[model samples]
Target: MNRLSDKEAIDLLKHGDILELGQQANKIRQEKHPGNTVTFIVDRNINYTNVCLNECRFCAFFRRENRKDAYLLPIETILQKVKETQEAGGTQVMLQGGLHPSLPFEYYLNMINTIKTAFPDIVIHSFSPAEILHFSKIANKSIKETLQDLRSAGLASLPGGGAEILVDRVRKIVSPKKIMTDDWLKVMETAHSIGMESTATMVLGLGETIEERIEHMRRVRDLQDKTGGFRAFIMWTFQPGNTQLGGNKLSSWEYLKTLAVSRLYFDNISHIQGSWVTQGQQIGQITLAFGADDLGSIMLEENVVRAAGTAYQMSIDKMVNTIEKADFKAAQRDTEYNIIRRF
Candidate 1:
């Protein structure tokens, strides 16, 4: 496939037939991953705390510091969750949380070290770019130094959250207080510089235009060209049910179309993930034909999306069956997209 210019991508996204777009994306997927296999990981999303300093308009998961329900998970409680994840056949834990004003940098280090010490083998895919920037501010460290410290403390990779859209125009409206576009890229670049790989994500339907969506992909593709550190690109429609950014959910067609366009545009990134967590099981299955080679996670626990009132549950057996019913083999993978088990 020829590399698409930004204008060409926007044109295709705005005027292309949904089925044809999906076909083009599926061709790319087949070329990249020849085998007819969809991969998933067994993981749990552990929110260490809900107390947030940045009260973004699009978030339903964050609480003010003084909220009655705001609480941080104790180290022992985190350990127990890790133990449960291990027993449930999980290979990774996506530990993310909102920015807390009072938690010192040492608290994060201790959390990472404690989890790694208890479960040496489980992949610790924790923290978003926003969280990293917060740590840097409080610790008085550069982004590179903060990433290095986290790596030394056993943070394997990043989850690519808090990146609603890379365009500052949309970002200012949705999550004004969070780190902006360049800061997010800097965190990923710094991580990649130190040999850590992470994924890139786009949360569409944030009242962004088609051009803006293409712009988001262009930024990610440009950074991938520089570092080649991003393993995959995942796009999900914004869930606005219970959030301050309330609007009707985007249609399944829009989700699939944007996802398909993302696959075609992000030619540099290797994998595309389908979000069953937001779109439900059937659309997740349809995504296999539309360019997703990975079905995201058989999440043992997910809270943020649940808080937004769009939760879909998937067990190991159900995940495999869904993939198979879509006429593809299902496989389990680790944080780095390495296949672990095939079914």
Candidate 2:
């Protein structure tokens, strides 16, 4: 099949029949992954702190430094969480946190090093490009320098957080103080340049036009062409309960249509992950038919979405059953998308 041009993708997203789109996307998925196997990762999102300087309007999780409930988790507490995750048979720990102003560069280096030193087997897929940008300014280092320092301190890879959308117009209205589009791409590019792979993510219903959504994918696809660094593409809806940008969630129909379009648009990227965390189990299951091959993270701990008043729980048994009910073999995967065990 020929690559989808931006106009072609936008047209499909706007007017293509939903089932037909899914059929095309499913065909592509089958071509890439022949067997009826869907993968998931057993991991935990250990947010170290809730203090944030950039108060994004779309976020309900962050708090000012002086707030009574704001916190920075002690290293020992974080280690305990990792220990619990390991005991639960988890192979990855995602250590994300808000951009606290006072913590020195050594805080992150020490945290990553401590986690790695204590748990040598667990993958530390921590931090986002926005946090990396914050670290660079705090440490008086270049982005590349900061990334290299973190990588040296045992940071394995990056999670595709903070990339709500890649269009600056949408970003300005939603998260003006956050890292802009190019900086996000730059951070990912630098990470990929140094062999630290990461995923690409998009959030729908951010009031972005269909063209803007396709533009987001276009940038990611262009970057992947330059650096084959993105391991997967994950998309989900914005939760808007306690957020300053509070509004209704987009329908599952729109989400699935966009997911199918993402499958067709990101032909250069290999995997697409469905968001059970935000969309719940049933829709997560249906995403399989829409071209998603992985259900991301049976997260042992997640607070961002919950903070926004949306929460869904998934256990290993339940996760396996979700995949099995979708008529695909359920398998546990690691941070690198390597199959760890099959159920």
Candidate 3:
């Protein structure tokens, strides 16, 4: 198989032949994995707090400082969630929240330390690029310095949210107040440099062109080529409900095409996760044959993307059943894409 160049990659995606692309992607997947197993993680998105200062246009989750619903989770409540996650046999806890200006730097460090202290076995894959960019502003430190501090404080890796679209023009229109395109990449690059790995994600269908999406993948691939720390690449459609930019959602078919395209393009990224949370369990099952090896977390609790009106419930058993129904073996994994259990 020839490695498709950038232009060839974009052309194949824009051709809009999902079935053909999916078959091509499956070939690549078989060649790479040489196994018929699908993987998922039983995890919880423990949104530590929702009090954010940066009110981006596309978010419906953040509240101002004085909003009645704006409350921070105390240390005890967080531990309680961790206990529930442990009991549920979860191996990952994704801790992400709004960029609250006053939540001092120690607050995040302390939170990670406490989560680690209580549940040392559970992988803590918390904090996205948005939080790190916010932390840099509040702590008056470089992205590298902030990441170093968090890494020392038991922060294992980052989940690439707030990277709605790495194109600044699109970002300016949607999440103008969020970190710029370059800063987002800078944070990830710095984290990779220091040995902390992360999974790359994209919220497509935000009126971005095929070229822009390819460019974003290229950026991720280029960085991964250098550091080799990225574990997986996940892409989902933008849910445009209860937000200022109230556009239609991307159909599951379109989402699959893009996901398959990502698998074909991001050869350096070993795993591609399917988003049952955003796309539903059935299409997510189809995505297994469309170049996705991992079904994303069975989120015990989710908010931000849910706040945008996409709350798809997926239990651990259902996730496993769906994966198996797709004619592949089902396995559970941890945050670093490590296989934990096979069934």
TM-score of each: 0.99, 0.99, 0.97
- Please list all clashing residue pairs in model 1, or write none if there are none: none
lDDT of 2: 0.94
As a TM-score, model 2 comes out at 0.99
Q: Give me candidate 3's TM-score against the actual structure.
A: 0.97
Ranking by lDDT: 2, 1, 3
Candidate No. with top lDDT: 2
TM-score preference between candidates 1 and 3, better one: 1
Query: On residues 1-343, what C-alpha lDDT tens digit does candidate 1 reach at each position?
Result: 5898898888887899999999999999999999898999999999989999989998899999889999999899999999999999999998989999999999999999999998999899989999999999999999999989999999999878888899999999999899999999999999999999999899988999988888888899999999999998988888997899898888999999989888888889999999999999999999999999999999899999899998898999999999999999999998988899998
How would you encode candidate 3's per-residue C-alpha lDDT over 134-240 as one tens digit per residue?
88878899999999999888888899888788888899888878888888888888899888899888998888888998888888888888888888998888888
Instruction: Note the Cα lDDT for every prediction shown.
Output: 0.92, 0.94, 0.86
Q: Is candidate 2 or candidate 3 better by TM-score?
A: 2
Model 2, residue 192: C-alpha shift (Å): 0.7
Query: Distance from true position, residue 175, model 1, in Å?
Result: 0.9
lDDT of 2 by residue, 1-343 (tens): 8999999999998899999999999999999988999999988999999999999999999999999999999999999999999999999999888999899999999999999999999999989999999999999999989999999999999988889999999999999999999999999999999899999999999999999999999999999999999999999999999999998999999999999999999988999999898999999999999999999999999999999999999999999999998899999999888898999
In the predicted model 3, the residue pairs found to clash are none
